[model samples]
Target: MLFQNVIKHCRHYTAPVSAICKPSDVFTNLSNEFPYYLPKIIKTSLTKKKYEDNIEIKERIKNLSEYHTLAREPIQGKLTFLAFDALAESKDLTEEKLHQVQVLAWAVELVQSYFIIGDDMEDNSETRCGKPTWHLLPDVGLLAINDASMLRSFIYEMLKNNFDQNTSTKVENYVNEAFLTINIGQYMDIMMSKSKDFNKFTVEQYNFLNDHKSSFYTVKLPILLALELCNKVSQDSYENVNKICTDLGILLQMQNDVMDYIDRDSAPVKTSSDIQKKKCSWPAVTALQHFNEEQRREFMNCYGRWESEKVERVRELYKEINLPHLYRLEEQRINKTVLEKIKKLPDNATPSADFFYKIFDFIHQYTEDISPSILKSNVSMSAI
Candidate 1:
């Protein structure tokens, strides 16, 4: 029924089909370009190292490539590259610079894949990118864990190989710092999920979680890294640009949280794993504010259970609280505030700002459209 309602509403949602760059398009271009950076696996038997099992390493990279190039959905690895694209479009970049950007873009995607594998294992997720998560595969069980590490190491290797010594050092340090930030954010997120105490979930905590966990890696780091590569960062307002990027990251993460409940395409189940796990996601946190004491008590009784009826009840409660409508309103408010900030940005920052606008527009088509009421009334039509 939830899926049906989403379908019913999505038919009315509209955005320009021409101007928008599809995630699939980005992924396709990235995939075609990714292999150029991947080293040809060594086939010789004479190799000496303490931990490097050549055969296993080859298999891992092979699997990584296969996992990334999934025919149906492939990894949406291009999310990071949007920033790179934005920077490149801001000026006419040379082929050599373009290749450097592509390598770094692939590095960002590799980081994403590395974390996704670990996150799925931690969440006990069944699927990712429309396929069984790498860890869940028949041959990959626990080996996927090591493969994730390999993926991460591959990033540094790529950086060292492709970049000048000084540039590589800075880039590596930036990525390492981002990894630390995301790990801290992940720790807080895990702790919150384990606690299951909604009292601890506040707007401040939400912003912190999203900022460190999702913002840096998803938006800010990519833009910062690409701008460094483009030599455009020093000319712009770094703090202001970072503020817009972080705010957009929170909005994107909220959209992801909402989709977990409403989109069946994410996993095999009709119900959300976040609801089942009792994670204090944006929707759950927002929906809690609308419930009366009695209703709140009743809601908690089924908040993290594994029953179909309980999940349905939770959905009904969400609808009763008009969360779908309120979510649309919040989205519009955030978008408006962000666009205003972008408009006020200094001239040097405008191109990057426009790039952000374009990326958000492309993402909103999927993230916001899945909400039934949001899609139906067309209440938040974002110009592309």
Candidate 2:
């Protein structure tokens, strides 16, 4: 049995001393350390197709599958966090159980990859994972849409093949439901951009959007799925896990919004696309709260033009209002609140809570992606 065989590997595994090890140290080898079961799963699904006899169709499937496999690299550790946390909490903590969780983690990553490919196409994004997006490749174009669906379909294949048939059905339902929620959130976001009304955007709506679109998939889904697989989730624990993970997700999404305005890379680039898209993001919505008549008018003037000059103008306006400082302060406040909430989770949910805190620390403490200005001082949330 795959589960029993998993013990051979776990026997060699040495638990790292906590605090001495970085989260990166835990996840740095995810792509290499974990078996690449995703490609095999994808191949199994693709091979079942009757049209494989067609040479051209076969080549396209091969190319799409290869891209899918290639994109799985540089794992972001979302799955690692859930799998290891579940393993930590398990009474058995057997190699077989850990292996099952790891496989499910791959499923989570594959689901994320599916959406990312489709999202890039929707946003007309040029690059992903430091390379051209799948849709942007020569002759791929709209065919990437089909490829994205194929990836989504492969998630079910992985679940069905790896788990008990009955349990796989539940997992499949959860995956589909999560994607539906994400699609609704995406729809709201795209509609908000199309409407282009900054005045109508509110903190409530921003939170609602992130809660559905970013939080559910990025944090809640992975933890919940892992817990389900472990047979460890309870009603109260489920509610609490969702609450904590949702908050963390919203905080992370806001960080993304703020980072958009800042110089994230060594090289300077164009201003954030949110500015160009006129998307109602956390930072932008917060800025609106503080904007005076003149500043509001100035913002309205440059909010959503495709021109680089207009984007630059919005960047300057953000500085004029000290939006960056305000954003930093808001982030500090949110981070504190999220940490406090995580700490308050019930004893039953400690594994889930610890998983969240590790992620929070990794993002807030370990990563230089966030500027020092944001983390250095305690800022009042009511400052605005």
Candidate 3:
């Protein structure tokens, strides 16, 4: 039924252009366009909770449910929307906010789908969310790359279809900027793992990487997309929101890093992904920052290698250095700052504040004590 719904929408646009659009061209274009429809359908079928405002936002969230299915191996249609519905609801919905909400909800799903698919391949991960990963399916390995690309393209299609041409262009610029920023962050993440000069990385570098990689898509782009869609952008608001979201993003990733050290069951990938890859995650960098020379040498020796003992050693070192406590302290400070900034927003700008605070609450729940096993799980468990 979900696929049929998407096919129906694809037919609406494809039939008229069939004469001009090549058969292959139509199929390919429609394939990209169809994914957007899936998210909407999935959200509707999965979500039953009643919201007081922004029914349209709910509708848009329904659109976002498609990605979970797309990201999974057996790829059941029913399970697709389960993850994103929660994320959509986390942002208070409103009629005026529907388009932006839907766009962002769809964008987050698209971004996650792309990253996880590619990450599966890069990490050689065999399974995801208790199922085979996209790259692990028979004949799906390298094709996952193309699938990821299509996921990225679908974000643009959704933007263009929902907004006027002018707003679409701005949205395109915003997506492109975020895309490039995340790519840079990904590159830094990969490079940090490979570099022998692990000592060269500072806490500032860790912050920079997380801000660009995690923050851009997770916080900065979503809020900015919402504001821009509402024509709410201004020099002051833009600067202020950007700073706030960036800080939030770094704190979120730092929490993620801390979770890696503490929560063993929830973390999806191998514990060694960060260490084996020699990733310069927050905990590692912070340990380096605070640890004395002898402790630092022990950290360097234990990290950047794949031995189980070394990994255990690194974990012990984190506890010994009280990195978790430091992480909690930073999270509180950043969260307070984010809240203060939200409170300062002009009354007319309440939607942005509402949307932002909703996300902050959502992130706070998952990242506070337990490390979320997979980011998608938060979306799944919280669906409507």
Return the top candidate by lDDT. Answer: 1
Candidate 1 residue runs with Cα over 4 Å from true position: 1-56, 65-82, 89-92, 235-237, 265-271, 350-356, 359-363, 371-384
Whole-model lDDT, candidate 1? 0.63
Residue-level lDDT for 61 in candidate 2: 48
Computed on alpha carbons, the lDDT of every model, listed in order, comes to: 0.63, 0.61, 0.57
lDDT by residue for model 1 over 23-123, one digit each (tens)?
45444565576655444322211133343466666666756854643322211235445656665543535566666766676666566667777878888
What is the RMSD of candidate 2? 9.0
lDDT of 3 by residue, 1-384 (tens): 121222223212222212322324322332344455555533443343344245764443332234354443211111112112222342434443443444555655566566766666776666655566666667565766766775676567666666678988987887888778878888888887788896667877888887777777666665566556556667765686675667766765676666556655663433225666677888778788788888888988888777889888888888888876787667666666666666566656534454445455544544465435454353222110
Query: C-alpha displacement of 187 in model 1, angstroms?
Result: 0.7
Candidate 3 off by > 4 Å: 1-100, 266-272, 340-362, 371-384
TM-score for candidate 1, residues paired by index: 0.78
Question: Which wins on TM-score, candidate 1 or candidate 3?
Answer: 1
Number of backbone clashes in candidate 1: 0
- State the lDDT at 137 in candidate 1: 88
Q: Stretches of candidate 2 above 4 Å error?
A: 1-31, 34-37, 43-77, 80-83, 86-96, 264-272, 349-356, 362-368, 371-384
